[model samples]
Target: MRKANSYLDLVLNPFNLFRTKRILNINPTVIPQRKEPESINLYVYDYDAENIHEERLKNVKDCFTYKHSNRVTWINIDGLRRTDVEVICNHYGIHPLVQEDILSIGQRPKVDEIEGVMFCLLNMLYFNEKESAVEVEQISIVLGEQFVLSFQEDASRDVFNPLRDKIQFRQNKIRQSGTDYLFYTLIDLIVDSYFVVMERLSDKIETLEEDIVRNPNKRTLARINQLRKEMIVLKRNIAPVRDMVNGILRSESNLLEERTGKYFKDIYDHIVQANDLAENYRDMMMNLHDLYLSNVNLKMNEVMKVMAIVTCLLAPATVIGGLFGMNFDVIPYAHHRWGFYIACSLMVLIPLVMLYIFRRRGWF
Candidate 1:
């Protein structure tokens, strides 16, 4: 029972590391014929608008009628928080390891070839105003010869919306295309979003660069450091996925069809662009550090100049005060009242003369 509860938590608990709080599950089966042995079973389950466990089971059963070779069925589950995900995974012959991977949120982008299926886990990042940070989520894809399975951290909103729309419209090549094409389309959406996120990061770096150059406040430095850390995290998550996507593009698997390879190529291109942008941002961050140091040095020089002028102006006054402070009765200022006035005038006049000389000489 304890182990079972742990498993339950894995499926039902919302993982926050990636900033996502929702999940969507898609189950597609391919069938070749509707009659006879029904060689393929096609089920496109749109698990939207409903969240009940019984409803989930009923929906899965509805698609269980026939498995035929001529047809491919797709099932899409929109909410990640539902317990039905675990239930459905158990109902299918899906490996517990795959289910484990799905339940574990915040995993980096990666690819795993398990048994005969290719499991691809990807990260999608979005800037969240509420959180004031980039929110990341895991998108898991299972590729097989007959069908493909996909899972999203949140079904409520995501890059996969376009793929959902394509499925709904039934007008595009998606409906007529193979499951591999559908997979490629989904990948294309993710890669495109990566570009969008890269642009946001680049803009941030640019802003920081400007701030550091013009006004390098402590607060600005803090923000730049924070952005640098975020970029490092982003790089760690994205780099491996770039390599994995490249591998998929070059693989001979029919899982990515010949026509669909172009879509993967597009994703690869975006990954390359994103990688370049990330490196550029890192370099800019280093430059900002140097700029901050330079600003500090320039400010110190300005402060020293003001101090030097104040000291120079006070030199003559100090000398006159010392002469009057002497205990010698023979001092001129100590003897006559008019002598004190004369001494004060000399003290004032001497600083003015010195100041003029310094100004003329450009010593200041």
Candidate 2:
């Protein structure tokens, strides 16, 4: 039967040529996780010009008092799973769509203005040297008049510790300013972290450039491809961040004060610089790939040239041996006393003559 033949083909086809014949569902409600397992940690800190209060709570509900306090409150929820994002969303009046975006770890860098909150989504990128790959984590920030809430996918690591130190030491204007300025400081810190990632990438590119020149091999090619992929991931995350900062500048929301506009613009400029660096690195990666290919081809051509010279040198001897190997009774040197010596001499002489000609032509 035709159906039996079809089933047999499906079972016997080693290449799985018909694997794609199955219909694909265009709509699916799967929540994709891009990283390994994570644990949730909540940090709540409230501060003013002369005083500071910090607390690390195991539950999000425990921070309700600080969230509603008169002072500037910074509630950072690191890791997405343990605490209910919906409860935090309800506490802050965050939109349903924004809550979904927060839950979805793979959301791109963006900015959204809801009823009374300013929402931002961005990626924190770092180089994992042990794995030789770039790791990305999403950071979500919700800005309000009295509170600033941040969400991240990983609780084990972050780039905000310096900002925290600055705030605790009362070393900067962060304590003297309002929540909007605090928001600005946080954004500035995140943008500054991009430079660190870019620096690592630059170092990688430089090292790879040297490796390509010194000893290009399969491992070198693999590293080049890996770097290329990491660069792409950086560019993908950073390009939208630039646009998001620009969007914040153009937003008419009162949450961002007019005075903070300049700060956002400064962040914008930094993102642009980072983007340009990523682009330059991409171009360098492409050039390295091309150089690796050309090097391989040149080496192959050298090997082929040597082989061709060897074959040419042996051709004369091969012809002479074949001619004398025949069983003809009347060959040219068949009866000469020194026929064997003369034959050997010609064989040696012919190759020497060929070698001289090849040398003159600079074949080697």
lDDT of 2 by residue, 254-290 (tens): 8877988898999999999999988998999999999
Report model 1's TM-score to 2 decimal places: 0.75
Off by over 4 Å in 2: 1-29, 32-39
Among these predictions, the greatest lDDT belongs to: 2
Candidate 2 lDDT (Cα, 0 to 1): 0.83
Tell how far residue 70 is off in model 1, in angstroms: 3.5
Per-prediction tally of clashes: 31, 0
